[model samples]
Target: MNAKTPTSPVPPYPHPAGGWGSVKALGISLMRDGAPLATASALRKQNKPGGFACVGCAWAKPAKPHLAEFCENGAKATAWELTDKRATPEFFARHSLAELRGWSELELEGAGRLTEPLRYDADSDRYLPVSWDEAIAGIGRALAAQRAADPRATVFYASGRASLEASYMYQLLARLYGNNNLPDSSNMCHESTSVALPETIGVPVGTVRLDDFEQTDAIFFFGQNVGVSSPRMLHQLQEARQRGVPIVTFNPLKEVGLVHFANPQSPAQMLTPGETTISTQYLQVRNGGDLAALTGLCKWLIEADDIAQARGGARVLDAAFIAEHTQGFGAFAQAMRAADWSAIERGSGLPRDALERAAKTYAHATAVLGIYGMGLTQHREGVANVQMLSNLLLLRGNIGRPGAGICPVRGHSNVQGQRSVGITEKPELAPLDRLAELYAFEPPRERGRDTVATCEGVIDGSVRAFVGLGGNFLRAAPDSQRLAAAWAGLDLTVHVATRLNFTHVVPGRESYLLPCLGRIEIDQQAGGAQTVAVEDSTGCFHASDGVAEPAVPTLRSEAAIVAAIAQACLPPNPRVPWNDWVADYAKVRDAIEATWPDVFQGFNQRFRDPGGLPKPNAARERRWETDSGKAQFIVPPPTEHESDPSVLRLMTLRSDDQFNTSIYSLDDRFRNVWGTRRVLFMHPHDMRARGLAEGDMAHVTTVAHDGHRRELAGLRVVPYDLPRGSVGGYFPECNPLLPLQHHAHGSHVPAAKNIPVRVKSAVA
Candidate 1:
């Protein structure tokens, strides 16, 4: 694992995010790798009213659809799923588990759609296709055994790829079987947002809607790259720029998406080869410095307010809003005033004048929209980082305004939806009382394990079984070196997925791969074709209808598979009619309505809405639902980074040619990384300081002294537009360098954003 393949020199992609280049990339991926006509037809339906939801990211779709609503990533994902290729039983027969383990991530995925249920063959060390009946029966028997040994021995992990209905059943199965060991991708990606937003704004989800972008005077992007994360939002950002809205970006690297954008649909613009400038100012804040940068912004605003008060001038802070709607302002203001300018300057890696300018831009605008991504979440102080942004918004009454609010740009189409319906470890987050009353079972109240804790449980033999709904769980997880072996040691591991992934290769003692229908494929039940729902980032519920033919006839719907697993594993319960629910998805929706009547009432009626239906957000109405009955102005720690000066903070990057954990090819068009994912990005000054040059093979080692000397050797060094004492590399590839124990303090999200590391040139 220490040695990596040689790669081309990382040449930066100078073009804006979407344009002729994106079109070219999309065409290449689809035409060469996927069924072009099939995927193109699917793309026409993607993000449209009653169409399939792109599982790429959770960005909301516009009410009125454009000609092509899908982005390059979404299109690539659709094409990837709608491919003619198949990792069929014959393919498995040709390659043993050991041989497949030697294959690359892209190769393993390129093996394509999993045709049927596969069981691990210990003697041959290969996967042999098994009948669905025998497969689920064996899984049920093993799962029951684990539960019988100890209720906590079985853990269920659901990824964001699952639909709302499928995820609901998955969670129900876990609780009914005893224990609440439900660790999910939400815990790994945006657990910080779930924890911090509720503590500050009285809501766990973002209050801003798609229409809010139209009226926002200013937009602040904290550690988000729109081009890769969700390119569909580029159109809105472009329109905002045209309307003279100021967009200020605070990130370690100047992402091209935040730089400028070209609408691929606009014939005149595309033909003319022109792109609109996106950001008014791009400040390269150091990795792990978001807390400091945000604190500095608040500090300047506070100081200015004090000076204005002394001069008897107009008030800078929203005094009326603060007094009426928020609590803890006095403590927050005092803490901001006490923050040292020297510490802020050092921590942010930007001069005081830059902070003043950014703060003035924010103060100058009456309505400002605050948006952030995972960059602000996967840190030791991630919760505080989010709260500080909340504090800044509260300073000017940004929340509950026409064009202003806090928006956490979540990844995954149904990640929020999954969490909304109780696929979470936190008992209080869900309507547990209602679920218990309706299901006739006492749902466990004890706080359950998260992603990291789940791994620990697996390693220590406490957790004996795992069922992944979807996702490359083992590959995407942090500290791959530590988890893979322990994960294989499990008694049972069931993966319900559409296609092959790295996890399929890392089989457990008793492993089963149950292929499921893709989102683009039609999912027919006893009633007829069913529509699955997904919640976008803006608290809107979108119903998606799959219209394509199934990749294989043997593939079952996720809901049906979950129901079968439940039927096979658990004793019959009249209260929870597993068969009746799968027979009609509408009944499942009615049950979901019954479980959360306050929020989800009239769910079946709302399905008739062409566009998505907005979920009620008290924060949007300026109604504080916190324990204190008011918004909180949280005080952030002055210093965000506590590492040694020599230690560089490494933030993980996503390649343009990939979606989450699924690499399409080796080519990264945005970063211009070709033929490899082992490249490391660093500032030139930092590289010079370490006596490293471009294309130099470097060994990156974690600074953590947790007895695990996690290191990624022979990572090619590439200079990037980043601040000093910071580096970045493609995620999950460099995930090995992140120790399992190093995570967000409160949220427990792995600190993939700012891993403390030291780099040195590797020997040839």
Candidate 2:
């Protein structure tokens, strides 16, 4: 490796996920942010019984949380939000929007927190400071004008990072404005699970809780890179592995954390060279082959069950559970039997013997816990992909049983909670009836636009206003360059955020950036201090109270911003006491209980409990809420993107040092990527087949053939342990190569995992 390589010479990080490396990373983050002492105080309160929830991942905290409950990323997030650095008006005045546009994601966010509201000045080509009142009032006026024309003319987007109170208020505000056009970060992540899980098990979320992990006989991981996405989960995994539980992993890449873990919380393990092995069996399936692989598992199980029953051996399938609690089993069994072994092998990139061996592991286990992430959901057949997993779970009566259920690893802290609290485009599920009765206003009943539809609306001139709660919308989107062009046509864009992002720089005609407090910052109001609740991936609604002073005095809570904007947009409504709720979040919780009595019956009281109340999952108790009043076993259609040797499957990855769109640094230690984000990972044989070397630069272009041109050039190819025809690259950068129209079948989430691409030589 020389200067020509342009990347760090270090090989792939050989160490486990969480040890001294995590400690070093946290130290660097605190040092870089200049918030060691300040963040230390915040870190002490992280994930505690009466403290703030971690913004790093949506994983739940234990009943008795560790003294230092936060993970490396958790500490980094705390340090990031509590930093002394500030991107005040002076910072914006110095950099023109065009100049800022050229900056990297890390460079943009590294400038620190936004301290004041800013309005983009076209004349000066910079953001000019504006009072919070004026900014909120302007947004209100724009929404009013949009409402006068068409309620759907404005779309309100919520980031999964906001609290439940904020999301409830945000959705209410949107509905009160005469439209249900609410889209959130979930549209880009686990919307598939929200659809698939409920259809299969009568619940949209995971049924398994923390205690279930302790009882499971076996664990299956699909698609989620827990090490990078949620390393905190590694503790549970490590404990399960140590308990002699059979841990099986199904992914295109054998991620480090899934392979092994060195628990940082344990001194005995961290002090030694030894690391605990996590996965007993690792299956490297094809990029778009998870559905095929899952179908193979079902096929193996059905055949094995028949053999066992005929031979008078012990039963392999849960006959009684299936007969009593489920429907569609016969059709599901028929599909599995009809599936060709040859087709399964080709589609799954696994031989019949290998799948059968893996099936044996599942068949032997009485109870199994299945978990998945974006790898399964961000595909054209995402709904089917998840349904296939549920099919397997049903064969063994996994759901509603101890240590046996589905776990969809969600991104963004409260993304799941956001949907739970009515942040959805579906009219029937938007709490319309209760909201209308409570507020004395008829709520919108028509279906609203999702993420994809919003993009179409942006281009067609149907939507004129864009209000984003938090997170980088433009960069996180697919066909980003195209959407950015259309975004400029919007009449107004308002971003409520704590820091700068690409969305802020890609301003609309009258763009306004309203700074909001982070989850770990003090949110004081008329009630002295405010505490909001966030629901984790497992449906634990825990309170998050900021311990540190806010990044700036001008910052407002997310709920407060939503209230002010709503007040500005609509005339005075005595029924909806927006001001009162903002002053005391408890009032907002009380409203939540009234709006959805069944789900949050004792919201205010339960939310105040230190351990937090775990919302009931009917599926956990073998109760089906589906139309048929029984669990379902759906059979998915054949894969549309069949195997093509010439076309390489390109899946996007998140660098360990980054979150969704916020890059903490350039290096990704887990993957051994350093000093650059332009590197690509592929199998060595595949690299050789393309006449490419390890360090050779290549041009990657999408093979979607959707009449849309997309490509990435000057990327250094690095031979790694991926499937033969599949390659990987970091997200957002590779995001340009993903077609906006290419999305999940039912959920419409961007199918980014297995994109058809051609890696050609760039040395012309």
The C-alpha RMSD of each candidate to the native structure, in angstroms, is: 2.4, 2.2
lDDT of 1 by residue, 41-153 (tens): 88999999868989688899778989999999999989999999998999999999999998888988888898999999989999999999999999989887877788788
TM of each candidate vs. truth: 0.98, 0.98
Q: Model 1, poorest ten-residue lDDT window?
A: 1-10
Supply the global lDDT for candidate 1. 0.88
Lowest summed lDDT window (length 10), candidate 2: 1-10
Clash pairs for candidate 2: none
- In lDDT terms, how accurate is model 2? 0.88
lDDT digits (tens) for residues 214-256 of candidate 2:
9999999999998889888888888898899998889998888
CA deviation > 4 Å runs, candidate 1 = 1-12
